[model samples]
Target: MRMAYLILAHDNRAQLDLLIERLLGPGGEDFAVIHADRASPLWPELRASLPEAAGRVHLVADPVAVRWGHSSLVEAIAKLVREAVRLGSEGAHLISGADWPVTPREAIAQTMREGLCHIEVRPGHMEERMQTFRLDTRWLRLDPARDRRAYAATWELRRLARWVDAARNRLGLPRSRPYGLWAYGSGWWSLPADVLAMLDKEMPRLLTSGRLRGTVCSDEHVVPTLVAHAFPERIAAHRRYVDFPAGASSPRMLTAADLPAIASSGAWFARKVDVTHEPDFLTLPDFHPAPMAHPASMRGKLPVSGQA
Candidate 1:
């Protein structure tokens, strides 16, 4: 079961370089597709850093400008999945630039072989909240100030939006139905090739549906929702470690102090690592660069060990 790591990155070139090294190693067969934010200027530096593993590491030809609380994140993910599927990868893991593998390569390979799609399902009420308001309608494009204003405006306008949606539903007017699929969970996942292929084929319809166009954080809902509706049996707990403190809007930046917890979490990866805050963490024995392989031979080949 060949696996593809689809990474979404905007900044932190050094961190991304480290992640690629760990995942691909000198000659590891697993393929990787990196989608750098279109707004970021670090792609050149990122590409230059991986001269040795050019064959296995690919950059998404068309990258999306991802913004927080927006659907562009889903667009970026979809782009990565498309590339991975084209490469004939059997499974694909979605991760971010700040994320690093915590599970051993062998273990991750075993999980992929088992064909589990890792994602978390939210509670019933939370899911309802996500779908209740037409948050996406407020901001149709990526503008930091506009995005922030739209987000802030939602709290004050949610009640009205809900009433409008309810009235439209009762009147049998067109309403956003998210590809006629239910929304659920955090957006990150590791899915089988068949599922990814389905997504690739269906994405055009979803994008055109206008349901998800202006939705805030639709990326968090789109994939899990699709998978849950299409392949419930394949859904598994998302095994990536994240630390969200009470009342915090985002996951906390992981430091060396979190190493013990990270090791014990049984997670395949951990996120939000800052090299400046934890410079020594990257130097740990586990993160040592993999031995270089002969690039000529590894080009366009399936991972030597995990082929299905």
Candidate 2:
């Protein structure tokens, strides 16, 4: 029943602190692991603030600078999973720095049995082919109001660097495969320990394959594609409320007014929650504890549809 509470965090110190506090109170000993980016010194400061996280902190060494449209972030996450497995984690609860878990811990434990149980979306048969959605070239290009091509171009630069590495390897030089893919969506995820180990083992192959580099957000496709290819029958496709995307780098910021909308979505976790709004969210009347049964263990994973 060992659950590794894993957070793929970057430079959001305030949000991370609030999230950690809500998830693990003083002296609470739910095994946790944090894969903090090298660019951000937030991990040190956070560890100083909460001494409990000191031993639990598994800081990334030789940290690769991650870009929104780059595959480095995905690689970092995979590395974290591998480290957790090495440390003897049975399963992992994948979450973002901005997310706050609303479901009761006891219930979460009941539902997850070394298998996937976090809120996520299942890609339709046709959607499965869409491995990458370049935010600049595809959907973003269609929306004139939102254009992030300039920012996305940064990832393209990284892709070029990876191509150079591939070229050098062709020339008989010692080289390593580049982990540079664009990925996004559904920040919260849970995976069985065995699946995680398999993913970790396959990292090198996924990185070297040029097919996934062009995608704007590869996070969405990486796990699903890997899991589908590795263990299709074991995969549980649930379009529950757990897969809502938070408005972090989006054009708009999520606010208190969105609570009613969130409740209606039947999602388990909400992202990018401001400190001021978290207490209010906990006290809302619609907030019901997860059902005693494990099947309904995720907080707010009711069956509804909107943003999720």
Candidate 3:
């Protein structure tokens, strides 16, 4: 079975090259790589580093200039997913520039053979809150100026927007969800081809909708939410390992000290790894070998918590 790897990358070209090599080295001919580089000027340099065998690796044209906690991240993912679907991928794995696959090729094949989709969907009322709130007002062209006067004006506009939303909520006005679908979970996911096709079909409408255009971090809510709406049973806690130390807003950059736990976690991948800081971690003897057991065996065990 073929799998499509959709990567949203902005930096760390060397690490990304190594990851592509490993994924295509053994038992990987059927695998395809679709990438979106956040409009970095160095993308051509990185693309040149990819091996010829990486013929299946395709970099997206017209990549968005992504900002953290903005809708542009979601737009990049949408572009990658659209390209992967167009390439006729049977399954798709969404990951970041800093992410590396921990599972060996054999284990990845086994997980696909079992027909499991790796995604985390936490159950709660937060989905409702996400749909109801309007925190992404920056897209309204209210912050055109970078000066203090502009900043003050933008702040006031945001305050007014929030107040309007609050009053609308109290009055029970017609607030719509993202493409009329409930939002859910961290945006990272490993989804089946069918679900990806569904996403491709719906993305245009969602992207054009005013609700998503003005929402903050819609990437965290869009994919898993739509996937859950389509097939709730396929939603399992995500298998990517991410360490969020207490009080930290983002996942800690993984280091050599994290190798043992990462290996034992039975996860297929881990994120936010910087090879420059810890060069030895990736070269460790046990880092790339296929686990003896199937990854599906560890399903439903890991917690579903992490920033996108």
Compare the candidates by TM-score and give the number of the best one. 3
Backbone atom clashes (below 3 Å) for every candidate = 4, 8, 0
Q: Model 3 residue 264 lDDT?
A: 91
Task: Indicate the TM-score of model 2.
Answer: 0.64
lDDT of 3 by residue, 158-244 (tens): 687688778888888846764345556666788778888888988766777755655666677777777767777776657889988
Cα displacement (Å) at residue 168, model 1? 1.5
Candidate 1: where are CA atoms >4 Å away? 43-52, 123-125, 128-130, 133-163, 169-181, 283-308
lDDT of each: 0.71, 0.55, 0.67
Candidate 1 residue-wise lDDT, 63-99, digit = tens: 8777776767777888998898899998888988888
Candidates sorted by TM-score, descending order? Answer: 3, 1, 2
Clashes of 3: 0
Name the regions of candidate 3 deviating beyond 4 angstroms: 32-34, 44-51, 132-154, 178-181, 284-308
- Give the lDDT of residue 277 in candidate 1: 40
For model 2, how does the per-residue alpha-carbon lDDT over 80-159 read when each residue is reduced to its tens digit?
A: 77776877777677776766665555556566673753434354433422332332323222333354665566467657
TM-score of each: 0.80, 0.64, 0.81
- For model 3, name the residue pairs that clash: none
- lDDT order, best first, reads 1, 3, 2
Off by over 4 Å in 2: 26-29, 41-51, 117-187, 208-211, 237-254, 257-266, 276-278, 282-308
